[model samples]
Target chain A: MSAVASMRDSILRADTRLSKYHPLSRILFYDDFDEGVNGWCELVGNHAGNLDDIREIARDFRPPQLSSCTFFDIGTHGSIEGTYSLKLATRAVPNHAAIAIKRLTYMRRGLVQFETYFTFKAEQTFDRAALSGWDGNKAPSERQFGDFSFSNDICDGENGKRYMGLVRYLNTDVDGNLVQKWMHKTSVQPTTRMERQGVVPPNQDFHTVNPDDWEEIPGGNQPLCFNETASKVNWHYLKWIMDTSRRRMVELQCNDNVMDLSSIEVPVYDGHYHGLPNLLNFLLDVRTRTNVRNFLYLDSVLVSVDW
Target chain B: MLRRSFTAVLEKNSTFTSDFATEPYEAGWALEARWFVRILEISPGAGLTMTAQISPDGLFWCDEESGPFCLNEVGLASMPLRNFGQWLRLDARLSGKNPHVKVLIYLAVKG
Candidate 1:
């Protein structure tokens, strides 16, 4: 390595906050929830002046919160770094989802990387169903969490190609059976325009044209640490890299597991979209399988780019 | 630094014919909160009774100390709140025969 490059790496390693992240050439933004929710907002669907025009599936993605990660059992568990984290919470209704997005525009897209420490949980239920034979190590609440996803919206330019690159962790299927796998979407996201044109049917899953249009990634069956309780919170580190020039995923790293995503197909919209140019948006969402609220919490986020 | 504030649209053009509660929102860091309800359309002689609710955790909730706010006509109404615990939501009940109301709800918090 060059002397200048070595010196820069040494300086970055000395900084405690930046040490945990392996950033690209340029650090675009670093959001520490200790300060506040930095530009992260609830994702609302495109609508005219009338909110009634919003698609049913996209209407009620609940608002994001600055959570202290507190619980009735432990009071306040706090965040990894400070007192708060950005939280997206679903309602206690089956299939209900909550989403949060951070909007940005890229100057030049080569390679963009997003890194965060996040955790997921289902709300604590007082009443428990009787179990015939139970293992004490596994918590039932783990099966209540349907899924959580990371997705992006990128538009080349006006009247240009628009595509979404997404990855999801399915904790349980609709029947409340634990799946514990990572999956990628097979169909393009159904947009309001597509529905208006009668080209797509009403969607149950917000990420794809149909609820079943998802396939498990190869070797993606990995169970995360639920800590055997609903009240206990354990944060996991995730880092995803996407190649914008090629419009494809590079890799995904969760904790010690690294998966190559270069072969994953990223579905693009066939119809041209207007009014969006240089668009770059990052989204996070959580869904519940049973009538229990699910939550996704991010302690911090760092976005960098090699432009 | 200036005091941080946020305004969340809890409900937007939501029509309800029966009793319902807004989604729970976490505002433990905020010292003050306010609720804004905009009644877009309501059936003749129909009204809504809204009560501020607080939760120790996000799961269970109880009514706040302040009395409920009543909306009897089309327009906007706001309720200011203080000393509310970690979570906040609005519980609304429809009144008058076969009543239905379309409304927008906003929660503003500052710390």
Candidate 2:
């Protein structure tokens, strides 16, 4: 490395928080939940004045919360660095999803990287039937948790093509069976305009046109550390990089596993979108497969870019 | 630094004919909270009782110290809460013959 670049790297390595993340040349934003939500808000559907006009699937994504990671067993688990983390929580109802989004507009996009330390859990339940066959190590509550995803909505400019790139960690299937795989959507997400025009049916999964339009990534069957209980919280590090110039994902890193996602296809919109020039939005969502609330918590986030 | 404050829409244009509770919200960092209920439409002679509920965890809940607020017509009502532990929600019970109410609920918190 050059002398100037090496000096910059040494400075970043001295900082405790920034040292954990590998960022690009220029840092855009660093959001720590201890300082509040930091512009993370609930993702709602498009509606003109009337709330009833919103599609049923996109109406109630639920509000984002600043959670202390407290549980019934433990008083306060706290976050990785602070007492709070930005949290998205789904309802106890099956198929319910909660989404939180951060809106931004790119200045000059080349390579953008998003990094965070996150964790997921299913709400503690008192139902005795779910714990019938406890193996003493693997918690039954692990199956109650569903899946969580990180996605983005980006548009080049006015009359430019728009697309969403998403990656999901499938924790359990609808029947409470463990899938434990990383997957990507094979189809584009249906928009409200598409539903209004009858181009697509009302969606059950928000990420794709059909609920089954997802495929497992190659060599992606990796089980995360659920810590064998509902109350215990273990944070995992995730870093994803995307190339705006090429409109493709570069790679994804979670914990110690790094997956090359350069060959994966990102479904783009058929037509151009207006009123969204240089649109860049990041989203985090959690979905419950069973009748138990699922939660995704982000202790902190750092977005950097190579421009 | 100035205090941090936020307002969340718990229910938006939601119509209910039976008893229901809003989703649980975490506000452990907030020192005070308020609930605003806006009744957009209600059946004639239909009314509902709204109560503020608190939870130690997000799972189990109990009623707050403030008494329930009852509304019988189209209007707006609000309730203030303090000393609520961490989680907050609103439970509403519809009353009268085949009663139904369409309303909007907002929760504001500050710390």
Q: Which candidate number maximizes lDDT?
A: 2
Give a tens-digit lDDT track for model 2, residues B42-65.
999888999999999988999999
Q: Write the per-residue lDDT of candidate 1 for residues A177-210, one digit (tens) a residue.
A: 9998889999999999999999999899999988
Instruction: Give the residue spans of candidate 2 off by over 4 A.
Output: none
- Candidate 1 wrong stretches, greater than 4 Å: A130-134
Please write out the lDDT profile of model 1 over residues B22-111, one tens digit for every residue.
Answer: 999999999999999999999988979999999988778999999899998999999999999899999999999999999999999999
Residues A18-56 of candidate 2 have per-residue lDDT tens digits of 999998999999999999889999999999999999999
Instruction: Considering only chain B, report the TM-score of each candidate against the true chain B.
Output: 0.98, 0.98
Candidate DockQ values, in order, are 0.80, 0.83
State each candidate's chain A TM-score: 0.97, 0.98
Chain B structural similarity as TM-score, candidate 1: 0.98
Candidate 1 has a DockQ of: 0.80
